[model samples]
Target chain A: MAIDWGFALRIAGFGLLLVFSILALLIVITRVVTRFASKKGPEEKEKKEERE
Target chain B: MIDYQTGFTGLTYGHIILICVGLIFIYLAITKKWEPYELLPIGVGLILANMPYTGLLLTPEQAGGVPGVAGLLGIFLEFGLYKYTVLPLLIFLGLGAMTDFGPLLASPKGFVLGAAAQMGIFVAFFGALALGFWGIADFGIKEAACIGIIGGADGPTTIFLTAKLAPELMGITAVAAYSYMAMVAIIQPPIVRALISEKERKIYMKPQLRAVSQREKIIFPIAVMLIVILLVPRAAPLVGMFMFGNLLRESGVVDRLSDTAQGALINTITIVLMLCIGASMSAELVMRPETLMVLGLGLVAFAAGTAGGVLLGKLVSRLSKEPFNPILGAAGVSAVPMAARVAQHIGQKANPRNFLLMHAMGPNVAGVIGSAVIAGVFLGILG
Candidate 1:
């Protein structure tokens, strides 16, 4: 059977693009969630320090 | 007339060569301490499979005849690898249980670097196409796709994709992927150093990583599963099991299940999986010019991945305010702690005060996700 060069290349292009986009979305979600977590961390730290 | 049948009766020089190859793998695993858990079993399986007329593993001819007539190892291969795709996916579950995504959660940019390292996969894909198109090798798109994943440096992902796309090439591709993964320390440093200068390697950032909240840790796997699976439903089986394993570990309520998944379950699956992978490497299947080409392409893919990660690290470092050691980018090849450790070793050598392990780990783990996503894409397209 003959190889489909066009299909292979298309998969390569589309695959890389999808991987980056999905990972980019992940990075965004992680940053947003961590932002809230970091905000809460400071307040908790302050309360602990005041109690001490 | 007395008829004599012995293993030696059908043995050929090719079988002997494969036996020697198996011994070499065993030697490397034991003395060299190279992925001993996998290579050791695989080496033994290779020896067992290559012994002529042993009936330990049925030839394809025998397998095609009667279902009950197949050997024990043949049954394992048929059911475990081809039938259910159980072993590789189970290995992924164990990997998920063992992995800690805290570093990745702390530094999300590592995800980008992780994605960048997959450049090797695409590059090798095109390279394989060119080879096949030019009659250099007889690789169809499916076979090419299988060969390309060796660049991911993720063993289970490689096996999973190869099994789905090109079952014939599974043994050689698995060997190539794991071999490079085992030799990350040796293969990666030169490429990393060549890509990034001494100044970049010496660049040290603060070691303190913000603590990831338990809630965030718990949510991370779920969130990842939803996002990745939604984007590439083909990746659901591997990603779902991986996330399930992580949830068990992070849930704080299932320590027993988590422990079993990470320890006993993983160890048992690794032995069986590696043996099956090795046993599949019979001389008739493995002793071909195409196998050598696949091995060569695998090395190229690995080198390209390391280079891609390091190069992107340089780009990200220049853009970010914090001091970023580009050496950590080499960890994005997804060989787990080995790639990260190599980054740390190289960084420390450049500057004793520069510790890049945790930083490298962010991208290192991200590479795992990245490879899985890429594999999913290939399966979606080809499978």
Candidate 2:
């Protein structure tokens, strides 16, 4: 089969973009979830203060 | 006169060469301790399969239509590798069970480093295609993709992708992946030192990461599974199973399942997978110009990946508020503890007070998810 240089370039370019984008989104999600989980209850807040 | 075919009669120059190659693998494993768990079995399997008249590689039909007995290695290759990609995925599940997401949660920018490390995969993908363009090798897009994933510095991801897109290239690619992973100590340091100055390497990171709460730990796998799978549905088989295994570990409720997946389950699958990988390398398949080309391209992929991660690490270090050692970026190539250890070793060499191992692991584990995501992308586009 003949090689399609244009198509191959797209796979390289877009494949990388997609990988970064997805992982970046995971980073955002992780930050949000951790923030929310850290603020859930007074008991947890008291425990955090004690540890600090 | 008795009519019986002796093993010596069937042996030829090609078989002899393969046997020697197997012996070299054994020698490396035993003497050099180079990936002994894998290389040793691979060596034994390669030797066993090449021994002519053993019927180790023959199916029932090939064995004169025998009903009771069949080739053990042949069954493994067909079922474990070719027919179903169960073994590699199960390996991922075990890896997930063994992984801890605390470091990644403590420092999220490592995600960017992890993604950057994957640049080698794409670079090698194009390199393989360029060989075809130059009329140097007969590699298709699928073959190029398989060769490229070796940059991820992951064996199971390489195997899973190759078995899906190009089964013909599995043995060579797996060997290339493992060999480079073993050589991380040699390959990474030079690239890392060249990219980051001694001043940058001496930068210190605090040893204590933010204590991750149990609730956050439980939520990580589920959230990753949902988001990643929704974005790249094709990644479900690998990402799904991997996260499921992590959930088993973190949930703290399924100690039995978690222990089994991490211990007995992964060990059993690894033996079968490694042996099958070794057995697949016959004389004719490996003794080709393309095989050599694939090996060369795999090295290019690995080097390019290390370069990509370190370059990004330099940028992140310059921009971040907290001190960051660029050497930590080398761990983003996803060789797991080995890559992380290399980063820690180099950092300490520059300054005795530096402790980068815990910080380096953030990108190290992130690289695992990064590579698996890219594998899903390739399957979605090319498969």
Output the worst ten-in-a-row residue range by lDDT, candidate 1 chain B.
Answer: B59-68
lDDT of candidate 2 over B1-383, digit per residue (tens) = 99999889999888899899899999999999998888998888888888897878775555665775668998788778887889999999999999998899988888999999999998899999989888898899999999999999999999999999999889999999998998999999999988899889889888888878788889999999999999888889889999999999999999999999999999999899998888888887888899999999999998999999999999999999999888988999999888899998999999999888999899999999999999998999998
Measured against the true two-chain complex, the DockQ scores of the candidates, in the order shown, are 0.62, 0.60
Question: Candidate 1, residues B1-383: lDDT per residue as tens digits?
Answer: 88878888888888999999999999999999999998999999999999987787874445787656788778778778876788999999999999999989988889989999988887777777778888888887888888889999999999999988899899999999999999999899889878899888889888888888888888889999998999999999889989999999999999999999999999999998999999999999998899999998999899999999999999999998988888878899999989999999999999999777888899999999999999999888779
How far out, in Å, is residue B99 in model 2? Answer: 0.7
Each model's lDDT: 0.89, 0.90
Tens digit per residue, CA lDDT, model 2, A1-52: 4799898888888889998999899889889978976435678779989999
Candidate 2 residue pairs in clash (backbone atoms < 3 Å) = none
Clashing pairs in 1: none
Where model 1 places Cα greater than 4 Å from the true spot, the runs are A37-39, A42-52, B59-68
DockQ of candidate 1 against the true complex? 0.62
The DockQ-derived docking category for candidate 1 is: medium
The Cα RMSD across the true interface for model 2 is 1.6
